[model samples]
Target: MNGDWLLRGRDGRLSVYQSSGDAVLCRVERAPGGPWDEPRKVGGEQRLLPVLAVGQGADRYAHLVAWRPTVQGEAGLVHSTHFRARLAALDWNPVGHPNKKGDRTGTPAVAVDAEGRAHVFVRNKGGGVSMLAQKEKGGWEPWQDIRGKGVQDGLAAVTGESGRVELYAAVPEGLLYWRQEEPGARPVLKESLKAPVRPGTLYALATSPASTTLYYTGTGGELWAWRPGGEPVALLPSAGHGPVAAVRCELDGHDCTLLAQRSASGRVAFAAYPTELESAGAWWTESGPQLTVDARVSLGTDEDGRVVAATLSPSTGTLLLTRRKDEPGLALEAWRAV
Candidate 1:
C-alpha cells in the first residue's frame, strides 16, 4: 500500500508489485498485461515493506525502492532497477542506509525528476525531513537533512511540469511541503498551508508545468482536491477507505483527471473530473460488481494509450486488470485475470 503497484515500461511490458509474506514480490509481463511470470522476491532476505515500482527516463526503466527494518525499528531504504527486461533482469543495487547509525524513518517516497534522476525523501527520526538525490551522471549524493517539525510520513513527491520536484507531508499545522524553485536544485520548505489532510492519502496531478492539484481522502473518507493557493474542493463524500488512485488523460478532447478508490463495500469506485477545473463540479461513478476482498486499485496507461486499472486479488494474490474501452469517457472492459 506504500508504493505504486502497477507500471508499464517503455518496452510495452507491465509489472505488478505486492508485499507478499516476508518479501516484496514482483511479477512482470511476457507481453502487455499477461501472461505474467511468477512473482519474484526481489528484496531477497531483506524483510521488505510494501514494494514501490516506478518508471523513469525515456527508456522508462523501473526503479524498485522498499524499506526494510533495521536496528531497533530503524528502517533502511534499498534501491534497484529493472532496465529493459523482466524485473531485476539487470542488477539489484542497494542504496543502503542514509546514516551509519541507521536512524528510524517513516515510509520513503520518491520522485524522478525531468532528467530521470530520482529524489528520495523520508521523515527522519527527528520528525523533520531528510533527502537523498541522484547525481547527474551516476551515483547518489549524501543524505542531506531537510529540516521540518511535526511532519508525518506517507510523504508525497512529484516532479512538476516545470521540472521542479515537490514534497508534501501532513503536519499538525496542516500540510508541510517543499518545492524546488528550478530544476536540479535542492528543494526547501516553501509552504506550510492551513489545510486539513489525511497523511498517506495524497496523490497529485500536474495540471501545468508549474501547478499541481493534490487529491486525497479526508478523515471521513470523503475525497477532496486542492492546490497550493486554492481552497480544498470536496469531490465525493464517500470515496472508499484509503489512498486514492489517479491519472491524467485526455477524454473526448478535454483534459480530464480519472480517479479510482476501494469503495466501502470492497469494490472499485471511480470518477472523472475536468482537470484543475473542479468548480465545474464532478460525480462519483461505480464500475464493476463489488469485489469480495478489500484491495487497492492502481491506474496506468497501456501501450495503446488506454488507462489500465489493476488490483491484486486478495483471495489469490494475483493481478486482476481491466482496460479502458477504446471509445470516450471512463468506460472500462471487464476485469481480466492475469
Candidate 2:
C-alpha cells in the first residue's frame, strides 16, 4: 500500500519516509536538485504512513500525521498520531492524538489556510468524514463528525484564494465534494457526481477562486478531469492504476498542471495539462522520461523554482531524484547522494 511517503519540507528540503522492514526510514535532501543525506531510522515497529503539513508564519514547523496499523487477534486497528519538528531538527516530537477510535480508513489530508489554522480530515471507522482544526494559541480542537456515507480511501484538499477550503472523496457511486467557505464554517456538501471513479485517490486544484479542476482515476484506469459546470473530460486513457499526483506550476511561461503516476508496467510517467482547457491542441503530447523502476512516484516544486520528480526503485531500494533541466526545453538530470 502507498503511504504519504514524499514530503517537501519548510526550508526547501525534500524528505521521504517509507517503511523499511519493521521501522520507518527517513532521508532528507538539502534542497531541490541537491544532494541527499543518509537514511536514518525514525520510527520503530509500526506500519507507519505519514502525511505532512507545515504551519504558517511564526509557527513554522513541519506537522506530520501518521497512521499506525496494528493487528490483534482478528480485529485490526489503525491509530493516528501527530508529530511536529523543525526543518533542521532530527527529533519528531509528538503533538496530539487525532484518531480516538484507533480505526482510520486512509491517509489523513491537511491544509493550512491564510490565518495559519490547520484543517485536518480523516475517514473514521463509520465510513464518514471526521474533521478537526487547530486553535489560535496551539493544540487541536475536538473532532467534528461531518455527516457522509460510504466515504472512500483517499482524501484530497485545497484552500482557494477566498479562504474557501474544499475536500474531495470517492464513493461507490461517484465523487463527493464538500466546501467550507471559511474557518468555523460548516462544510456543506457541494455536489455528488454519479460517475465510476475508483475509491482511492482524489486531486483538487484550486488555481483561483473562479476556476478549479478535480482529477481522479476512472474505473477503467483512465485519467479524467472535471470542472465546475462542465462534463467530465477524459484527459488520458489508460493513465495508470493509482492516485494521480499533481502540482500547479509555471511551465514555459504558462501555468500548467504537472501530473505524475506509475504506469501499468511500473514505470514513472508524467503529463502536463495547460490552463486553457478549451485551447486547440494544448494537451501534453510530449513524452516524459520513462524511469526503469517505480515504487510510488511523486512530483512537486521546490522553493527555488525547481521541479523535482522522485521515485522509489524497489529493486535497488534507491530513491531517485530527477531535476528538471530547462535549458533546451524540458529535460531531467538524475541526482543521488553518496
Candidate 3:
C-alpha cells in the first residue's frame, strides 16, 4: 500500500512508486537528493505490484505491469496489464494487451537493456516460465514460454555488462537463474544455485554493470549473500526473515552496492559492498539496526555510478545524501574498508 521501489530516469531524475489500494502512487524528483514532487496516482484499482524499467533518451520511459484478481463466471482469475510512462510527459500510457492473465505463479519482473528494449518475465498458472519482449519500433512480442513448469517464488531482472539480460527467481529447492544473451536471444536456464531454504525471499544487487549479488535471510535471522565467485556468506549476524532491497551506486567516491534488510529486532539495517580496487572481490560492511521495519529502500547515483542519495521507504524518512561535509551519525554514514 506504500511505495516499495525507486528508479532513476534517463533525464537524470529519480522516481518512486508504491501501491495505494487499487492504484499506484508515483513521486518524482529532479534529482535524487532534491525536493520530491507530490505523489500522483496512476493506473486503475486492479493494478497491483507494479514493476518498472527506464530506457534511454527519447527512448526514456517507465514500463509498468500489474495484476488484479477478479471473479468471472464463478472462476477466480488474476489478470495483468502493462503500461509505459514517458518521463517527459509524467503520465502513464497503456501499451500492449490489457487482457493478459497469469496463472498467478509469481509477481512480474521487468528490465530494460542498454538498447532501450523492455524484457518482461513472469510465471504462468501452470508454473511455466514465460517472457514478453518489447520490439524496437514499439510493440510487444507474444509471450514465449521459456519452460513449462510454474514457480511460486518472486522474480527479478537485471542487465549485465555483457548487455545480456538476466532473470532470477526463487524456487522451492534453490535459486534459479536464466539469461537472454541478446535481443531475440533464447532463454538459457542455468542449474539451480544451491542455498539453504529458510528465509523467505531473494533480492538481487548488481554491484557493477557486470556483477550481481543475491542476498537472502537464513535461519536464526542471519543475512547471507551469494557472492559473485564464491559460496554464500553470512552478511549480518541477525537479520529479519523479510525481503531485502539493494542498489548499485557511487558511495564516498567509489562505486558501491548498498543493501537494506530488516534486523532480528524488526528495524532496518544498512550495509555496503565497496569494490576492491586491486582485486575481484569486495569489502562488505554491516551496520547496527535502525529505522523502520521493511522500509522501502533506494539508492541514487551520478553518471559515474557514485551514490548521491538513499531514500529509505514509507515516503516519510530522510533522503540520505552524500555528505556535503563530513557528517555525524552512522545511519547516514559511508564507511571505507580498513
Candidate 4:
C-alpha cells in the first residue's frame, strides 16, 4: 500500500508498535511535555489499539491503554498519551489516570470526536465493558458501564455532521450502538443486532459519510452491513476470518465502499461495493495481485479516502505500505518496498 510513514516521535521515545508480524511499521506515541511530561512505554503483553484523532486543522492526538507486569506480582495498567506537533501546540491533553480495574490482558480501544475529545472503551477481565469519555471543557469523566458478562470485541466511533458522536461496539450478545448529542449527556443506546450470531474477535467497523450505514465482517466469514431503518444484509458470505478493512467515500458523486481482506492462502485481496445496491448479492470484482509478504496485512484509510495497506516484509522483517488505485479498476499506486 502506498501511504506516508513517519517515525511518530523522537528517537528512543518508547512507542506503541502496530505491526505485521515482526515488522513494526507504524509507531504511536503519547503527547510529550503535556500533563504527563514524560515518554510513556506502552508495550508488555497486551495488544493496544492506538487511537488517533485529527482535528479540522493540522492537529492530531493519540491515546492507548497498555499493561505492564507488576513489580512483585502480576500486571499493572498504564495509559500512553501522545500529541502530534500540531495538537501539542493546541494544548490537547490526556484526561486522567488509567482505570485501575481495566483488563490488564486485552487491548484497549478508543475513539475521538471532531472537537478533540476522546471516548475510551475496554473489556475487563471480569467480562465487564466500560467506557471513559473526555469532555470539551477539560477533565476526565467517570467510567461508565455499557455491558456486563461479555467481551467488547471492537469499537467503531464516528461524529456525524450534526456534531453527534456515535459509538458502536461488537459484543458477544450482538452489535450494540450508542449515541450522544452533547458532552455530559449519557449516551443513549440506539440499536443492537441479535441475529446471525458473531464470535468473540476484534471485528472491523466503518461508516459511510453520507448515511449512518455501518459495515463489518462477522466472525463467521460473512460480510454484514446495516443502516438506519434498514434490515441487516449479508454482503459477502464466503469472506473468511479476521475483520474486513473498509473505507467509505464518495466516488463519482455516489457513496462507495472499499474493502480488503486476506485470502486463505495468505494472499491480500480487495473488493469494492456500490452504495446503490440494497442486497448482499452484488458481485465483488477483485483488484490486487496475490501479495508476497510474510506477515498478515492491516489496512486503514487517509482523510481523502485513499486505502493504505501495511504488512511486514518476510525477508527483511520491515513494515511496508502501498496505496491502491484504479485506472478504470483497482490498481496499485506508489509503494514503499521494504
Model 1 error, position 52 (Å): 4.2
Better of 2 and 3 by TM-score: 2
Better of 3 and 4 by lDDT: 3
lDDT of 4 by residue, 1-338 (tens): 11112222332221223333311223432342112122222323333233222111112445444344443444443444445422222222333323453225344555566666666665566665666777668766777776545655455555555445566666666777677756446567767777544543233333544445556666666777776456778777535464555555455556666666556555556666676364535444443345543444555554345555655444554544565563444566754543
- The estimated TM-scores of all candidates read 0.90, 0.79, 0.73, 0.68
Question: Candidate 2 lDDT, tens digit per residue, 229-303?
Answer: 668788776456767777677778877777777776556666775763633222333233444544666776666
Show model 1 residue runs off by greater than 4 Å.
43-58, 69-74, 85-91, 96-100, 292-294, 313-316
Quick one: RMSD of model 4?
7.5
Overall local distance difference test of candidate 1: 0.74
Ten contiguous residues minimizing lDDT sum, candidate 4: 50-59
Model 3: how far residue 57 lies from native, Å = 10
lDDT per residue as tens, model 3, 1-338: 11135555655666655555555666776454456676667554444433333222224455555554443421111222223322323334433222254224455666666666767676765666778777778766677777734354566566666556776666665567777755557667854666654523666655565666666665455566774445677765534556666665555566656666555564445666564221333333344335465354444454344444343444353333331123322234442111
Residue 247 of model 3 has an lDDT of: 64
Question: What is candidate 3's TM-score against the reference?
Answer: 0.73
For model 2, what is the error of residue 89's alpha carbon versus the real structure, in angstroms, after optimal superposition?
Answer: 5.9
Per-residue error for 265 in candidate 4, Å, reads: 2.2
TM-score (C-alpha) between model 4 and the true structure: 0.68
